[model samples]
Target: MKAKGRVLIIDDDAGIRDAAFQVLSREGYEVEMAGTAEEARRLVEEYEFDVILLDLKLPGVEGLELLQEIREEDPQAQVVVITAYGTVQVAVSAMKLGAADFLQKPFNPQELRLAVSRALEKKRLTLENIYLKRALAEKEGQVEFIGQSPAIRRVLEQAEMAAQTDSTVLLTGESGTGKGLLARLIHRMSPRAEGPFVAVDCGTLVPTLFESELFGHVRGAFTGATQHKIGKFELANGGTIFFDEIGNISLDIQAKLLKAVEEKEISPVGSHRLVRVDVRIIAATNKDLREEVRAGRFREDLYFRLHVISIQLPPLRERREDIPLLAEHFLKRYARKHCKPVEALSPEVLEAFLRYPWPGNVRELENTIERLVVFARKPVIGPEDLYFAGFEDQAPDLTLEEDLPLEEVEKRHVLRVLRACGGNKTLAAQKLGIDRKTLREKLKRWGVTP
Candidate 1:
C-alpha cells in the first residue's frame, strides 16, 4: 500500500527509533530512522517528509540546534520534538525554535502516532493556506466577461446554468475567445466557489512529463523526481480543474485521462494506488474535438465523457458589435494599468478595429488596445497612433503563398507580433493566443533569444 505520509524519526537511542519506526510503519506511514543528527540531515536533504520526530538530546549536534537548521532549510517543516520526563520546559524551548509539537520520552505507540498526525495536519493546513492565497490572487479580475453582445449573453446564460451543476462542461471556441475566462466565471459562480480553481495548459505540457504533471509522482518515481509531488487533479480536489486546449493532448494520455474522468480517480506516475478526486472537469479546446475524434487524434470515449454540457463561445469577429465596448473596456484597464491618460479610441481607429479579422480574437484586440494606451501621447487614440502600433499593417494575413513553407510563415507572423508588442514577450504571447512558455520555446527553436 502507498504510505499515507512520509515521516522521519531521529533519535540517538536505537531502541526508541526502532519502537517509533514500528509504530509509524504499522500505521501506514513510510518511516525512516536516523540514529544521529548527521544521518537525519542526510535524509532531510534527500527526501521530503510530512513530519519529523526529533529527540531533544542527540550526539555531536544539540537537538534544538538541529531543529533550527531543519526549519531553516524548510520553514514549513513540521518537527515534533521528543523530550525526557519533566523536560516540558525544554520542549517549550524547542517549540519556540520552530518545533511543531512535543512528545514525552516514554510515549507509547498511540502517543507517538498522535503527535505525528497533529504535525502532519499542521503542515497540510499551512500549505493549503499558501496555495489558496496564491490561487485567489491569480483569480482577481479574471472572472469578468466584458462583452454585451447577444452571442456573449447566450454563452453567459449557458455558463450560469452549468455552474449550478456538477456535470462536466466542454467549452469550445476559437483561440482567444475567452474560453478560459468563461471557465473561471463558471467556477466562481459554482457551488465550489471557495475551492481552488486549477488550470492546466494542455498545449504547453511536454508529452514526456504530462502524466506526472497531471497525476503527480512519488519520490524517486523517475529521474529528477526527488520528492513526492501532488498533481493538478489532486490540487483541484473539491473544486474545478480546467484543461485548456484539451484537444492538444496525445492519444496515450487521452486513454489514461479517460479512466480518471470516468472514475474520478487518478493513479500517480509510479504508484498503483488510485487517488479519488472530487473535481468538476471544465475542458476548453479550440480544436473541433468531433473532427479530432473522426481523424483519430482524440478518443471518442473521452470526447463523449467531457461533453456532458457544451458551451460555444463566439469569436470576437462574429460578435463585432461588442468590439467597441470591449475596446473601451481594455482601454480603461490598460490606461489604469500603465497610468496613461488615454481614455478612448478615435472613430477611424474603431472602424479599423471593426474591419480587422482579428485572428487572435479578443486577446489580439486587447493587446492592440493596451499597446495604444501605453504609447498614446494624448487623451484619445487616433489612426496616426495605430500606424505606430502596427495594428493596421501587421495584422496577420491568413492568406498563404503557394511556395512559402508554413513554418517560415509562422516564424514571420510570430516575429511580427512580437515586434508589434514592442518586444514584450508576455504581450506577444497573449496576442498570439499562446502561453509565454510556448512562445519562448518557439523562439528558442528559431534561434532567437527569448
Candidate 2:
C-alpha cells in the first residue's frame, strides 16, 4: 500500500524545491512545492500535510513567520525547518514555533528522506495516540501501520467502503489491532470529517452513570446532578460517536442506545423533551458481539443495528511480513522523540521481531521500540538490543513463585506460551523446549483442545 501522507515544500529557490519534490515523490509521498511563503500558506490552508519543509528564508514573508502561520493553521502539522549551516540559531527559533525538526541547507538525499520519514512517522503516531487516549485513556499507542499484505489492504478497503455511508459501522479485532484508529480514519474520510469526533469507552464507564453519560441529563436529574450535562451523543452531533468496547455495556443501556440510534433522538434523564441529534455511529469491540448477543449480555437488536457494516482488523501475527515496516516506522518515531542517535533496526533485530508472535499486537511492539530507543547503545539496534528490549520469549515460571505447585505452574506456563505464539501449539511447544505431543498432553490436562 502507498504511504497515506502529503509533504509541503516551501522554498524560494527553484532547484531546492525541485530537488525536495523529486526525493519525496520518489518515496511515495504526495509532494507539493511553493516558491514563496504566500503560496505555501494557501496550500497549507487548502490541504492537510503530514510533513512541511519550510525554508528559513523566503522572498516576501520570513520562514519563521510562515511557520507560525502553519502552526496556527494546524498545530499538529509536522513542520521541519530548512536552514543554512550557520543559521542553526534560526532553526532553533523555528522549533519554538512548533517546527518538528531542522535540516541543514546542503543536506544529502539520505538526510532529507530520513527527516521527512521521521516527521510523517510522528504524524501517524499522533493519530493513533490521540485515538488511544480517547478510547483507552492514558495508554501508549501504535505508529504507522502500512502493510502490503492482502489481509490489511482488504481491511482498508472495507474501511473505505464504510466511510461512504452514514450507517452504523462495527469494527471487530484483537486489542491493539487498531480498531479505534480505523474508526477515526473512517470518520476523516467520511462527509463529517470537519466535525467533532467523540470516543467513549463502554468498559470504562461506571454502570450507575452509563445512561446519563451517554444520553445527557437535565438539572436535578439525580442527587449529584447539580447542573445540566451534555452527553457523548450530543457532543458528537453532526459528527461521529465511537463506542469502543461496545460489548461491555449493559443490556439496559443497549436498549436506550438502540432507540436513540434508530430515532436519531434522545431524551435526557428526568426530561420529557426529545432532543434530535445528527450523528454517525461507529462501534468497536474486541469481544465477539455475536457471542454476546447469544449469551443475552448484549441486545440482539442493538447488535443488528451496529453490525451494519463490519470491518475485522487482522491481528499482527497473521501479517508477520508487515512487522519490519511497522518496526522501522516506530524506530524512526521514538528515535526522533527521545533525541536518540538511532537510525534503524539491524537485520538481526528485524529477524527477532519477525520471530516474535506479538500476542499483545501493535501496541506492544510500538511501546517496545520506544523503550529500545531510550537505551540503545549504538546507531543501529541489533538482536542484543531486541533482547534487552524484552522481545525474547521468557515468561516467569509459576513453579518458582510462592506456594505454586509444579503441575499448576506447568499448566500456566503452557497456556502462557500458547497465548504468546498466537494459538500455535507447535511453535509454543518448540519455544517451551517440549515436543508437540507433550504440549498437547499438557494442554489436554488443562481442559484445552487443539
Against the true structure, whose TM-score is highest?
1
lDDT of 2 at 270: 66
- Evaluate residue 134 in candidate 2 and report its C-alpha lDDT on the 0 to 100 scale: 53
Q: Write the per-residue lDDT of candidate 2 for residues 1-450, one digit (tens) a residue.
A: 544467889888899899888888888888889987778877876665678998877876877787887876555579998877436578668878888888987989899999998998786566545444555653335423478888999998988888989989999986678888888889988998876688887866889998998877767779988766667786676689999888878878888999999988787786664555778999998778888888889998889989899889988878998888888888898888899999998887777667555545777677778878988999998767755754454433411556756456556656776888899987765555443554665677678975
Candidate 1 clashing pairs?
Answer: none
Model 2 whole-model lDDT (C-alpha atoms): 0.77
lDDT of 1 by residue, 1-450 (tens): 756787889998999988888889889998889998889887776555778888878878877899987875545559998868537678678879989998887888888878999998897687577567657766647567988889999999999999999999999987779999999999999999988788998987899999998988876679998866778887787789999999989999999999999887787787664566778999999778998999999999999999999999998868999999999999989999999988789998888788665657898788788878878999989988987776656644544566877567668878888987889999888767667766776799799874
Q: After superposition, how far is residue 439 of candidate 2 from its true place, in Å?
A: 22
lDDT, each prediction: 0.83, 0.77
Q: Given candidate 1, what's the lDDT at residue 407?
A: 64
